[model samples]
Target: WDGVSPDRNFTGIENYTQLFTRPELFRVFFVSFYYLAASAVQIVIALYFATVLSFDLRLRNLFKGILFFPYLINGVAIGFVFLYFFQDGGTLDSILSWFGVGGDHAWLGDPESANTSLAGVSVWRFTGLNFVLFLGAIQSIPGELYEAAQLDGASRWQQFRHIIAPSIKPVVSLSVILAISGSLAVFEIPYIMTGGATDTSTFVIQTVKLAFQFNKTGLASACAVVLLLIILLVTWIQRRIVPDDKVDLV
Candidate 1:
């Protein structure tokens, strides 16, 4: 369907063929790489904070809430909020100005920085959920294990390596799968913020534009199918790499 015609035509594999042939397809996937990198950073940040807060700390609960607050907000709202924050002479600019950095830089307008800036927003918003996951997994470890490790004069790093790391292996694997899938399907933030401008269009955003904006429903459907296949492939590879095994936290 051309999205406007009453007649339905069969174009078996033509849509998929065109999809694969398009140069824009490469660009869109390349855009996804930025978010993929950001997701890795986000997971690390979350794990760090989760590990720190899992231990005794001043105002730990407060810090947890603060970190998780961004995840609680609606994605569209977060996108809009960051729009002004990234605009010239905006909140971010003012903050940078305090550090002797010029405020004239276009964080979202420049092609070079737009994707990175949007990826940063994604990292900030999603890190909290990963944090909660890591924190819970860490806290579930038996306190006696930490006590035993301490008795042997095990350093903090050693304890994490031998105990905390093994205990949270399942959660870590889950987070990685989620991050990779999320990175590939990223849409809301870039869509709402840049409307896919400045070379920031992601695969999902492109599919959406094809379906609604361009009235190419068939092509859009093909794109969606390809995305699903890509996600499944990635998930399968992840499961193979991190097979489910009983982790002894003791």
Candidate 2:
């Protein structure tokens, strides 16, 4: 409400200072590492799973349901789930204790590990959606092309290189666009899990903090506009770089 209120006073630090002017606000830049890493890992895993495990309809459906279920869950719930899992002597520690490591490490306690841990959660949560998308794209490629490649003595890697990758280029582009934008706009996971503390704060999380936490509604509004512009600019650049033309399945 304060963000758009015309009568609201614009004074002091909130009025004159923008995120770009404040060096401390630059912390969110580091958070982008998590987003980029998670997106890359998710896309690779999705492609691998779609290519290999998508042959059996029944099995594929079951696996897809299990993997995609996390996406259906509420973001706050996911945070709590992972919070307990990463806590000291929790699920992660219990598993690591078997290998004589991480018995005393706090996954969310350290600045270095917090963002990485959050990124891992994001990967686990969203990989299912990416998996389903890549699976559909792979399945859309005509089977006759694979049969022809097989007759020509083309190995699986060669077939993927000549057929699958090119044929699904458009889908891959779409996935990349989605991944980039979604990563930029990510909010709830970090917000709920760390409350933007421990260096896990993201762009969106900081925006909310400025508005509600510090009552810098005007600055928060500007921050949101900047984020929107960044997403649009990045997406436009991605489209310009990625070709939209369909590839020959043969």
Candidate 3:
């Protein structure tokens, strides 16, 4: 379905102004950052694994496939998986209870734990696919670069520092941009799992609520336009920092 379920009145940029009036805008921005930060860290971890795995090894392809498993599944399905994990008397709480520090906790229902739980699930489901992307990028570089670095008495860390990292900077930049934008647009996982209630409602999730639940289609459209602009602005900043020369687009 289109993100815009019902074409409503177009209010031009006024929808953008309403976003700041909400008291929870700061919290909204903070929760969104949680998603972005977690995703970025996950991508870093994935890149590390990808770099290590690029070397010849047994079942390398299988390992790559397995790593990317989470992304292939639907986002809503992934959300449900996490939903079950955090439910009262769920697997995670049970395990924690065994460790003696567990209290009766409602993961999604609690304000403090709720946003973090959603962000963590998002990272877990997504990072591997970026790993696969980075893997291909890391492997595509000519071996001569590494050879030359080694010939210059460069260490593995050094080679990665200058040769490997610079070569893959473009991929890293792209991944970061995707992470940030995706974090802002997040809806399915949060909405399905938490229903975006009790302060877990992100901007995009709130937009959905506005349209489908509240029938404020115009406001929802406004939220979407604001989100789009936010994404565009963030992307522009990233591109400015990384620049075209850093990334090997060709």
Top candidate when judged by TM-score against the true structure = 1
| Model 3 lDDT tens row, 12-102 | 6665566667665424666687787888788888988898888778888898887889889999898888889999889888889888966
Minimum summed lDDT over a 10-residue window in model 1 is located at: 241-250
Which TM-score value belongs to model 1? 0.97
lDDT tens digits, residue span 1-250, model 1: 7788999999999998898787876568888889999999999999999988999999999999999999999999999999999988999999998999974778888776999999999999999999999999999999999999999999989988999888899899999999999999999999998999999999999989999998999999999999999999999999998897778654
Clashes of 3: 0
The alpha-carbon lDDT assigned to residue 64 of candidate 2 equals 73
Model 1 alpha-carbon miss at residue 226, Å? 0.4
- Candidate 3, residue 198: how far the Cα is off, in Å: 2.4
Model 3, global lDDT: 0.80
**lDDT value, candidate 1, whole model:** 0.92
Candidate 2 stretches greater than 4 Å from native: 1-6, 9-17, 56-58
Between candidates 1 and 2, the lDDT winner: 1
Q: Which candidate should be chosen as best, given lDDT against the real structure? A: 1
The order by descending TM-score is 1, 2, 3
